[model samples]
Target: MIIQMEGISKSFSGNQVLKEVAFSLEKGEIHALMGENGAGKSTMMKILTGIYARDSGTVEVKGKQVVYKGPKDAERDGIAVIHQELNILPELTVAENLYLGNEQTVGKTAWLKTKEMNRKTEETLRDLGLHVKATERAGNLSVGKQQMIEIAKALMTNADVIIMDEPTAALTDREIQTLFKTIRGLQEKGVSFIYISHRMEEIFSLCDRITVLRDGQYVGVKNIPETSFDEIVSMMVGRQLGGRFPELTNEPGDVKLEVKGLTRMGEFKDISFAVKSGEILGISGLMGAGRSEVVETLFGYRKAESGQILINGKEVQISSPIEAIRNGLGLITEDRKTKGLITDFSIRENISLANLKSISTNGWIAKKKESALFENLIKRLRVVCSSPEQQAKSLSGGNQQKVVIAKWLGTSPSILILDEPTRGVDVGAKKEIYTIMKELAEQGVAIIMVSSELPEVIGMSSRVMVMFEGQMKTILDRNELSEEHIMHYATGGDKHVG
Candidate 1:
């Protein structure tokens, strides 16, 4: 085995986050770590990489026990981690970001080999089918491109053992295939990978073995060919989740929000749609198809060159997010870490940030009202946190996403827009989110969900609107929803709308 851990245990402030977990990775094997958020998957990997010291455990590398004081030490031993949260420095160039601390130096002198590094960066990216200029500013690229940069950064390490956390969360289908190909190539060279993702399709297709964790404890390990999806899910969530998506009983009423020829200069053009009360209008499209840009324009995050936004049959002006909220529209942005919540704020503060009017009186905040709101929403969403005072950044990715949803829920908006609502969420939490979405729709909230996952769009949408290259191709009804049909329209199969 290339790596092994026995009886791993860890805790924070007396709260046990991991307990007696065990894992092993064979050389050149693609091992999958499966668990719900806060189930100790990331924690286990952190301990393995010396990001967090285990309270009690034995970690062996190539049959020898080792203790790494920091991630750099672990890197020296051929273990590199690409964390779920990206580590890219946005302000730097692609080449600069790739070689940040590991730059090529001229012997013992401080002179750098810039030309060689850029050329190497270009070659590495090209190998992964990423066609970005090494001199381009990393911040200007799309999230999908940025994620590819992360993968490229990890590959540049030339580590024998690599751990990827949700590596394809932002990647396109083409990019994912390229990544898999790259991974297989590395495996052929005797490199091993510890793959972490909530995507079951990837696990089934790419991984060799699986290790399941539940509630911070080890479940069991199984070979890829020997285990079934149902069994693996049952083990991870500790219960049978009846259906991947809950039944939507909501019937559409009068239109709550409408856009007429919404045109944004270089992004999207002449976008038109209407979402009725108690209905979900799912926006489906490929990367750079302007799905997000359309929504951003509607939410006033981007300016529309020309368009008319009609909220409840009357044209309304939305020049900013504040105005959007004032008009009873709430947007759960795509990038939750940057746009959705303030990581430095506590749960109580973040939740109250959007609904101060309901919890305040005459310019003074009501503590009891705020606390009640926090408690009620936290319990409702099943957010895993020690207390309301816990920093938003401290929660797991899934929990942080739930908190973002809760913050918007507090606004009690008539129209709610969720952009990639469950991107990195596990199966169990996804069901809960679907339930909440259903409940809100039943209560007459119009939901606009933009998703790249076809299953989610097909399962939740009342109507799916496929966009191709900034134009609406077609909108299919629930009875007409299918992955094949959606993909056809998404790729400009038919140019007719409605």
Candidate 2:
């Protein structure tokens, strides 16, 4: 075995998050660690990487017991962790970011060997099938490229056992394939990996063995070939989940929102689409194909150089978010940590932020009104938390996303735009989100979902709009929706296939 942990237990502030969990990874194996939000998957890995000291446990590396004081100690022992949120300085060049703190120097002096480092960076990236200039700024690259950079860092450290958390959450399809290829190549070289992701399809296809965790306790471990998706999901949630996606029963009504000639120069151009009162319009494309940009323009976050936005058959000039809200538009932004919530605030505070005017009495806020709103939303959304007073940042990613949705639901929008609604969420949470969207749609709310996941777009959308190079290529009916068809339009392929 490459590593093993038994009887692991941990807690924070008397709240037990992990209890007697056990895991094992063999050399050159891709092991998947899976659970719902707050299920102790991350905690177990943290303890393994020395980010958190376990209260009680035994961890063995290559048959020797070891307790690492910190991540550096673990790294020195050939264990590296690449977190979900990448650690890359945007302003720094790729070479600089790659060689950070371990830069090559000239003959024991402070002068750097920039040329040599850049050459090495290019070579390393090329090995991983990533083609980019080493001198270019790291931030300019797509999320996928930045992720590859993190893996490159791990390889440079000669890490034998690497742990990746939600690695493909923001990657395009091509990028995911590239990442999978790189991982398989590394595995062939005897580099074992612990892959953490909520994507079941990915785990089933790429991983060799799977270990399931539920509510901080060890569930069971099974070989990928021996286990089924239904069994793994049942193991994770402790019950059978009826369907992968809930039934969409919302019937289409009149067009509630329309955009004609929506132009944003370099971002998107001449986008035209209409969403009915009770319809779900899905937007699908590659990373920079302007899926989010179109929604952002509609929400008044970006100014449209030329466009006519009609809501309820009346043209409205929405120049700001305040105006968008006034015109009955609610946007759940893509980046929840930065754009959706105040991380430092409590759940009640975050939920009431968008509808402060409604929850407030004159100039002052009404505590009772805010509390009632918080209670109602949490119960309705089934957000798991200690209390409404719990800090937003302390909640799991799935709960944090619920709070963002709750914040917007308070506005009671006639038109709702959700961007990557279940990007980093687990299968259980994803069903809950889909249920909520279905309920909203049934109540006559027009929803525009911008998603990269083709299955989600195909499953939920009443009509799908595919974009390519910032322009609307083709919009397909629900019957015509398929991964191949969407990719054809998304990649600027000819509309009529031969």
The most accurate candidate by lDDT is 1
Candidate 1: C-alpha RMSD to true structure equals 1.8
Candidate 2 lDDT over 40-155, as tens digits, reads 98889989988899999899998999998999888889998888766889899999988887899999999999999999999998887778999999988766578778878877
Query: How many pairs of residues collide in model 1?
Result: 0
lDDT (C-alpha) at residue 444 in model 1? 96
Error of 2 at 424 (Å): 1.5
| TM-scores vs. true structure, each candidate | 0.96, 0.95
Over 4 Å off in model 1, which ranges? 106-108, 496-498
Ten contiguous residues minimizing lDDT sum, candidate 1: 489-498
The local distance difference test score of each candidate is 0.91, 0.89
Rate residue 426 of model 2 by lDDT: 82
